[model samples]
Target: MRYEPISNELFIQNRKNFMAQMKPNSVAAFNSNDIYPIGADSTIPFQQDRNIYYLSGVDQEDSILVLFPDAPKPEHREILFLKETNPHIAVWEGEKIDEEKALQIAGIKTVYWLKDFHKIFHELMSQSETIYINTNEHYRAAHDTETREDRFNKWLKENYPAHQVAKSNPILQRLRSVKHQLELDTMQTACNITEKAFRRILKETKPNIWEFELEAEIMHEFLKNRSRGFAYTPIIASGKNATVLHYIENKHQCKDGDLILFDVGAEYANYASDMSRTIPVNGKFTDRQKQIYNAVNRVKKEATKMLVPGTLWAEYHVEVGKLMTSELLDLKLLDKADVQNEDPKWPAYKKYFMHGTSHHIGLDTHDYGLLHEPIKANQVFTVEPGIYLPEEHIGVRLEDDVVIQENGEPFNLMRNIPIEIEEIEDLMNQ
Candidate 1:
């Protein structure tokens, strides 16, 4: 792990909260993500499954966490199974986590090697009446590749068909939607690293600079700050490229008198920070660009204010649309006739701003939160508003990650990052 160690208490509390929601006599299992193979003898970098890492703080491959709160033996209540570290593995792949280290890292007293997993899990299944299986149920999930967890689920049903099954996704969706203090602190670190990268880019950006060059500068800053890299695929769109919402080719050279849109964030310790900012390549926005930029910034501010407790996600978006419509009217992009004739399902503002204004952000760029439920305190969200004009070859988006407060306004995690036109222009010209 390049990032500093996270406090084990976060994992402890997360496990406690999740177990509390489990049905009586239930055992839950979480599996580590597989190290996907690209070709012969080579594999993609391993990433621990977020669900297992959330409960155990164990970041490794071929690891498993099983929670059996109703187990007859006290040690079986919480168990961690890790890949056995032998002398050969030590020499070739470095030392894997041992028993004592797992205790310190995950607060689990009973640690077993992978070889004992089949016998032990069978014993656990014989004793437990129900099993909770972790599954990906995020609103945007579209998984085609089978995962280690999926394979384990299939094996579990085949071997132990008598055990009643339940989904862990619902419980996790509600629990993980609310952030713990330690999680918030780690996300703040991620945002701080992203700020450094953005500041560095502001200084390096100029006309004829390739978008990939700016991306390289971002990676340089992230690596120095102990972040693995961008939380999601970064979008470094310049000029008309910015109009594409998911532009990531990053091959175009920035042109003078054109604006560049950056939808990028750095990840520290697996916690994600999502940020978006658009600025002129020439270090100053033209009058037309300023009009669109200020309009988007205004919408972002208003939308963030609505992310308070008890605010429904669907209704909040409708209110944000009204705000954007007013801004579009002020910018002369839409007239009274356009507003009256627009479809209610797809408002007039959708022409310029086609995407949602906000989404939950945490371990995943589009993290988990039940959209139908009302917003809550400690829940983090990204407030991003944009106006894209492909004909004008201009695109402007301004985004910030904010935490909903128990009262008053939400706390902006990216407050230190430069978003104001004057601040960005001054830093770029300096």
Candidate 2:
């Protein structure tokens, strides 16, 4: 890992929290993500499964975590199964985590090689009444590919027909949604790296520079700061491209009067930071551009204040929609009649501001928080609100990561990142 090691206490606490929610005599298991193949002998880079990483802090492939709190042996309560490392294998792929290192990384005393998994798992399963299997149940998930966890779940169900099964997703959804201070610290680091990249781009962007050039500059900054790269595919849209929310071609040349909508962030130690900023290509917003920019900025500010503790996610979006509607009416994008006659399901502001104002942001860009439940303090979210005007060839969005507080407004994680029109213009021209 390019990033520094995280404290094992975070994983230890996470495991404890997960175990607390498990049914008595239940043994829960988590598996690492597979190294997916592409075409020939080549394979995609390995990404550790978030659940396993959360519980064990083990970032390697072919790893498993078993939590059996009621085990006869105390050491067997929390066990880590890692792939055995040989000197020859170490020479090719660098040193894999040995048992001692695994113990240090995960704070689990018991460790075994993958070869002993079957015999050990059978013995453990026989002692437990229920099995908790980790599954992907995030709201945005729609993958067709079967993951390593999915394969393990299938095999377990088929092999042990008599064992009672339970889903681990619900428990994890509630637990992982609340941010630990350690997690917030790592995410803050990722946000700081993203801020540096944005500042770098502010100085580098100029009229006639191709969009890809800006992408390269951002990547350079991220790699220099110990980040793997973007948390998600970056959208470096310029001019009319900004109106298209997901535009990522990044092939067009930026014009003097055009604006570049940058939806990019850096990832540190697998934690994510999401930010979106629209800046003038030539370091100066026109009269009309400034008006729209300030409007979106205002919406983002007001929307952020709504992210207090005990607020329901569904209700929060409704309030944000009302805020956006008021801004749109002021901008003349929507009039009183437009809003009054609009459908409740799809409001008048939908024409200019289409997407949701905010989403949970952490380990994943769109991180885990149950949308139907009330949000809690310490939960981090992205406050992004935008207005896209295709006819005017203008789109403005200002986003920042924030943490909800027990009282008052949320704390802005990207508060240091320049967002004010004067601040951005001055820095870009300087």
Candidate 3:
């Protein structure tokens, strides 16, 4: 791992919180993600499963975290099973986490090799009456491939037919939604790194520079600051490309007056910070661009104020839609009658702003959280509002990661990052 070690207390508290919610004599299991295959004899980089990482702080593949809070033996309450690294795996894929290292990384002292898992798990299963299985149940999830967690769930159900099954996803969705102080600090570090990258680009970006070059600059800054590159695949969209949400083919050369949409962020210690800022290729935005940018920025600010506790995700977006609708009307993109005559299902603002105003941001960029539930204090969300105009070749989105507060405004993690038009202009010119 490129990032420094996180304090064990965070994982300890996470485990304690999770265990408190579990039924008596029930054990919850979390599995590391598979190092997926790419082509012949090649494999994609191993990304640890966020849930296991959340509870155990174990970042390696083929690892298992067993949380048996009510185990007969105290030592068996929390155990970690790592893929046994021998000379062969070491030679082929480099040294994986050993027992001593795993113990330090995770707070668990009971560690075993993967080879002993079936036997040991079977013995443990004999004592456990219930099994808590985790599945990817994120609101936006569209997973097709079976994961390691899925396989284990199948194995457990088939082997222990009489055992009562429970869903771990629900518990995690609620728990992980709210941020711990440590988690918030980690995300702050990520946002700080992203701020550095953005500042660097503000001073460096000029006409004729390739969009990919800006992407490279952001990645360079992230890595130098102990971040493991982008939290998600960056979208360095410039010119008309910005109109296409999720545009990642950063091959176009930024023209003189074109705006570059940088949807980039950094990850530190497995925590994610999501940010989006649109800046001119040169030092200043055109009058039209400035108008649209300020409009979107206004919408973002207005939308963010509603992220306080007790706000429902559905209702929050509807309120944000009204904010966006007003902005579009101000931009002359929508007439008063256009909004009045629009379908209730798809508002007039949908033409300009399509995606949701916000989503939970944490270990995963689009982190797990129940949208149906009211927003809670300490929950982190990204407030992004954009206006895309394919006809005018303009798209402006301003986003920041914020923590919901009990009273007053939510705390903006990217508060240090320049957002004000004048601040951005000064930074660009300086």
- Candidate 2 clashing pairs? none
**How displaced is residue 266 in candidate 2, in Å?**
0.6
| RMSD versus native structure for model 1 | 0.7
Tens-digit lDDT string for candidate 3 (76-134): 99999998898999999798988788778777889999999999998889999999998
Off by over 4 Å in 1: none
Reference-based TM-score, model 3:
0.97
lDDT per residue (tens digit) for residues 231-299 in model 2: 999999999999999998999999999999999999999999999999999999999999999989888
- TM-score for each prediction? 0.99, 0.99, 0.97
Better of 1 and 3 by TM-score: 1
Comparing candidate 1 with candidate 2, which one achieves the higher lDDT?
A: 1
For each of the candidates, the C-alpha root-mean-square deviation to the true structure, in angstroms, is: 0.7, 0.8, 1.4
Q: Candidate 1 has which clashing residue pairs, if any? A: none
Ranking by lDDT: 1, 2, 3
Give the C-alpha miss distance for residue 142 in model 1, angstroms: 0.4
lDDT of 3 at 34: 91
Winner by lDDT between candidate 3 and candidate 2: 2
